[model samples]
Target: MTLSPLTSPLLEGVTHGFFTRAGGASTGIYEGLNCGTGSSDQREVVAMNRARVADIMGVEALAGVHQVHSATAIVVEDVAARPRADALVTDRPGVALTILTADCQPVLFADRAAGVIGAAHAGWKGALDGVLEATLDAMEGLGADRGRVRAVIGPSISQRAYEVGQEFLDRFLDAESDNGRFFANGVDGKYQFDLTGFGLARLRAAGVAEAEWTGHCTYTDAERFYSYRRATHRGEADYGRLIAAIRL
Candidate 1:
């Protein structure tokens, strides 16, 4: 099957994609385009999957970070060593910046007029710690205007599936009491947190030109995306990762 990547009109004129798990050479639990080299899937298979993605993006290779779930954002000149960071920014054409995630927000950033692009892997911890803002700052450092940068968050777990504890709620509340609005009461002591909502809020708070989530729930769409929480619930050994990329 050919790869069908989701695109946002907000990022028009930019070569970017929110790729799903629809086409690849993997099997069993890692079926479809599992591009994560860190996954337990065969190394060669993962390489092949990544090559397919790079080919579709019209790049020789994909550049990415180690994604430590921090707010660190690095500028990429070439696909050299993978640093321990969560976001990557680049102004160089033909260099596709990629991020891998399983339920976490796969955010793509671009300031087409400035020729700068970025990709970030934002989990709850990373989001709360300002990964999105860090991405914009990095892009700005590359001469991209934050006011002209458009950010699009790809498929991620929705509030309906994101049950959280009081501690999780407290973390956001401690950040700002207004964060309480992102949570909805759930059964028992659980609260359903709106991660995408929080992400967009952060982006807007940081003054991005525009921001939007694709609104596809990773946990709810097993056929189209991968979800770490879903795999954990099913008692699976591991899960595949979905890839999102953007290029100038």
Candidate 2:
């Protein structure tokens, strides 16, 4: 089956895709195009699925690392046998940089004039750990002017459906008092936190020229997206992760 990739014309003339689970050789709970190496899905199927993505992006190989949800960034001049980081920035053409996520944010960045681009896996942990800023820093390190960098966040859990406990709110407040604005009170003392908004704020704080979210909610949209929280609520054994890639 042909892969389904969501794109943004705003980042036009560049090679990038936010892939969905509509095509591939997977079955069971991990239906289609489950590219996550961390998943319990068959490794051979995962590899095949990934190879398809590489072919579509016109790259020999896609460079995706072991995402530990850290703020760390690695600069890739060429595709490596094994990459060991969360975020990747490169000026290397034809080397597709990929990031994996289920409900977390998958952010793609490009500074076209400098021919530099980046892909990051920014979950709550990574965002608070400064992954967004770290991505911008890595891109600038590769001669990309931060002011020329354009970032777009792919599908993630949205605020309306992301209810959290007071403990979660306490953690953010502990990090920064101003973080309170990202949360709105829910039932009782529960709060609804905006993951995409928080990610956007991080990008803006890092001096990104323009930043935007695709505004799709992974948890709420069952047909088009995968969601860890939703899967857990449904009592599923495991959930498939989606992939987003960008190349220069």
Candidate 3:
């Protein structure tokens, strides 16, 4: 099956995509294009799905990480065993950096002139801990100029669907009181946090030449997205993961 992936003009020159859960070998909760090796969907099926992604990206393999929601970013010289990090940056030709996400942000970065690209899995915890900035730092280390980088955030849980308690608000406020701008009051004392907006702000703050969000809300689009929050709310056994990738 042909896969349908979203792209941003900001990354026009880079070979990258924010792939939706569309065409693949999984069923049930992991209905389409479930590329997550960590998921319980049959291991062979996961491998085949990833291989399909690699083929689409025109790369022999896609490089990725274990993604533990930390701020760690690693530079890849070659595709080997997956590292224990949340982001990856590389200038190597023919290697595609990929990241998996459900409701979290999948951010892709590129510096065309430098032949450097990066992919990050930025959940709220990782974003708060500076994973986005760490990704930029790693890209710069690989010879990508921060001022020439373009970063695009893929589908994520939008503000209207991201309800959080006072504690969540407090965490953001504690980080920076200005973070309050990214939240809107929900019912009672709950607040809605804008994951994509927060990610864009961080990317721009880090001196990226251009940054954009694809404006897709994973939680609200069940047919095209695999949303962790949606599955948990519906009491499903497991959820699929969406992949975003970039090649230098």
- Best model number under TM-score: 1
Per-residue CA lDDT of model 1 for 1-248, tens digit only, reads: 99989999999999999999988888889999999989999999999999999999998889999988899999986596699999999989889999999999999999988999999999999999999999999999999999999999999999999999999999999999999999999999999999999999999989999999999999999999999999999999999999999988
Determine which window of 10 residues in candidate 2 has minimal summed lDDT: 77-86
Q: Mind sharing the TM-score for model 3?
A: 0.98
Ten-residue stretch with the least lDDT total in model 3: 75-84
Residue-by-residue lDDT tens digits, candidate 2, 68-166: 888899998557644667899989888899999999999999999999999999999999989889988988888999898899999999999899999
Query: Over the full model, what C-alpha lDDT does candidate 1 score relative to the true structure?
Result: 0.94
> For residues 1-248, what per-residue lDDT tens digits would candidate 3 score against the true structure?
67999999989978889998888888889988999988899999999999999999998888999989999999986596688999999988888999999999999998999989999999999999999999999998988898999889999999999999999999999999999999998998889999899999998888999999999999999989999999999999899999999996
- Misplaced by over 4 Å in model 1 are none
Q: Candidate 2, which segments miss by more than 4 Å at Cα?
A: none
Per-residue lDDT value at 128 in model 3:
93
TM-scores for all candidates?
Answer: 0.99, 0.96, 0.98
Ranked candidates, highest TM-score first: 1, 3, 2
Looking at model 3, residue 181 earns an lDDT score of 96
